[model samples]
Target: MTKRRGERPPVPEALPVPVVDAHTHLDACGAQTPEQVREILDRANAAGVDRVITVADDLASARWAAQAATWDERVFAAVALHPTRTSTFTDADRAELTALAARPRVVAIGETGLDYYWDYSPPAAQHDAFRWHIELSKLSGKTLMIHDRDAHDDVLKVLDEEGAPSTVVFHCFSGDLDFARACVERGFVLSFAGAVTFRNAGALREAAAWVPADHLLVETDAPFLTPHPFRGRPNEPYCANYTLRDIATLRDVDVADLASTVTRNAERVFNLGDVVQSQ
Candidate 1:
């Protein structure tokens, strides 16, 4: 009933310039070992996707992501427990995440935030965990990576009440033009994934095109949200080129120029100087 990544579309051609995958899941993509991680990065690099921000959904995956970021110079990480999995959350979980968030290579504290679409976690628990994560992001001084899905209003409410970190990213941004304008007005960065390239995502594309260059970002959210002409396939960092190219074409800018802007945004937001060198 489901298609494995191997059964999905093949990798596309390389981009004109290197860009960072604003969000991804190397572990889910089957990069379980250091060698596997390197191999994946190699394929990504060949496609001009030189760096990535591997995201975590739970504590175990967060640890995996943190360790994976060290596997290569191109891999950075985000640490957090996803809102959908907060049903069994405890103080111990927060304690462990707090420690993991302090890791030097852990550039962002996120893939957190609310998700009303999934009923796995109670609304109250998800809200509480989101508040905790916001505190963690503040305490650790790391960028906050938000995973908003059908809960944009609550997500914004929490951010307003708790106050957001210095740099915040709406990973896999699914908002409409009005929502996009609202986020941009607050200086939040939006990372568009493959959904933007979908034919039915015209509103998303319009919102993306309206975003200021500095506030725009591109990601694959891999093994999922695979770009058009390959929507059913497993996504990887390498596939980000397709989304990048799409956005560039939509905005009528050079792909290289867009890449440079997004790469710089990723570098500054995550402070991944080790993985993102001057180019």
Candidate 2:
């Protein structure tokens, strides 16, 4: 059966254990009001995606993401000016983001790496913003969530030049096997998105399969890369379950075991011990 391009994929069976969607964009997923955010989280929770980190691409979305984290116990936020939106980066913007990074529930400063694929932001501005974000992550003692797209070398170079934060994650990791190994070597986490499930993404699957359990994570990158067989459809956090199962299959690991491992990894990566205990 061919699913319509505009359709939303049906939720897959619930996982044997809960896991976290390491990165997603609630605002981009059409979640505006508190009710909408709750509904999204409720749907994700039902599928064993108990927690999600809604990432921001700009100051507006950053504010919304930080605020949305408070709407539900299951939701957390990552704030930053995305690489593509950093063309006009300013000190005022940095100050605001610095303040947001200190929020208790804003667990990461990110989605702020290099993106050579998009011409929206100049390379120079992106590098400057990425460096500042690295410092902010260190200062705030939060995980640094990165958004690397077709700029792997430059991304690595900048992080090296700036000295990456203690906890750095490559959101929607688009790197190949060597890049994956490089990231693992640096103690940075690699988060796979739905794109890893695509039939044409053999290299990505290889990278996903090879990454160590402790350094691995999963995300939907929703409203963007809906997984295979549902490509072009609308995506939400619940879709992460499908991506997780596929990754487990790729790694030849039991789904439940992989779920447990990734859940634990996410908890530690985001410092969600208190949140998990509260639940």
Candidate 3:
């Protein structure tokens, strides 16, 4: 007798991996459990996304991100109080964050920086927290993942004044070509996200074209900023392909080469050599 459909052999996995998503929010994207995270990462892997940096902006989400990273080989965590969430930061919170930053799975000190858009937290609080995270990065010797929104000048000023860490990444880079040139000159990495794929993102594309190969990276920033063709849909780590393809087109290079180069840049910045093994 013929075997039941349920007993059919499993299909082999797809090949030809895409670029790594240097920044994502798998934990904040409603993938709280191991099973949920596995499903997200599996989808990403199927889409040729070899790895992801799961960033958390608050204490609870930071803990969850760390746990997810520890449990999954594909997920690396970046823990810090995001600019919007700095309202609740306390001395105890700083101590806890310091301890968490020392953890093996925690690779960076952000999703932190300036955001004058929402002002969910006061500007002063955000600045104070940003400085605190900068110090934390210096102490831990980890990379700094910055999140600047409508506050580029101030962000740059603070970073320069605080003597930014050697490895600085501007996640979801929203600056112009001039800003990008300055960042390149300063040896800072600029990570493009889904927003770069939007039709109205000519300025972002121009910046992408100008970013040095060694300082270019990509991210999904999932559950938000989904790329074109999926712009309005809920984003996930798997959608990183669109950003990578768009960036490659802007840089006038083969997609594979761009992907490989950005992946190497990310690994270098986040110290993910041990995690991005197969990529």
Candidate 4:
């Protein structure tokens, strides 16, 4: 049997202050049951990850994410079919997501942009689903969370053509400085994940350092993209502190200050001010 995602990586020391994980996947992290979710959150809280926005990649995961958000007050959700799954996305999936998006705890519609790196779905289908999700986000009054991997130009082009929703965020942002500038100019939030802490991620760090403080966000993208010194290990929300500390250090700012800034940004984007409070 495969090792469960929750089995690896020793939790790091807690941060000086709490911060929000702008994106994560509790299901992929192997915290599916109510007991498992509560335990996972307890460990995260100990590491100062005060709040989390768990995201989904398909219809089933979207349902799980929506339910998880209501399971714990600190948890909120982003729901959509992933780019690769777009080829199989159906009217039923759309209806399910539409209903989930209406729930107060389901705060965003996404992980739903383009992924040219994978051939699971044709470009046309991915683009079609992306446009539909963008519209759903706008209609439901939820932030549009994006997943652009190896398809930056097309992602921007589609957004330009579609007239983006009120709020857009690029989760697990994997772009260079120029692309970062393009996104920032358009007022899209760039969410940095654990990959930013890798040694080969110099360009990513540079992009992050230059992002206007208010436009920057941090995440774990956990059970994957485990941060430096733990790259091959499984990850969980408790590890967000590692990524947040690295980002603060790279930007030459105080960790606590950066924590407050990102927490504020997450709250504003997800409209979670009353939902997740500072610790």
Q: Is candidate 3 or candidate 4 better by TM-score?
A: 4
What's the lDDT for residue 26 in model 2? 90
The model with the greater lDDT, 2 or 3, is 2
Candidate with more favorable, higher TM-score: 1 or 3 = 1
List candidate 4 segments past 4 Å from native: 1-7, 274-279
What local lDDT does model 1 show for residue 87?
92
* Candidate 3 TM-score to native: 0.92
Ten-residue region with minimum lDDT total, candidate 2: 270-279
TM values, all candidates: 0.95, 0.97, 0.92, 0.95
lDDT of 3 by residue, 139-217 (tens): 9988999999999999999999999899999999999999999888888999999899888989988898888899998
lDDT of 4 by residue, 29-72 (tens): 88879889998889899999988899999998999999998788
The global C-alpha lDDT for each of the candidates, from Candidate 1 onward, is 0.89, 0.91, 0.85, 0.90
- Point out the worst 10-residue segment of candidate 4 by lDDT: 1-10
Q: Once all C-alphas are superposed, what RMSD does model 3 give against the true structure?
A: 6.5
Name the top lDDT candidate.
2
Looking at model 1, report the run of 10 residues with the lowest lDDT sum: 1-10
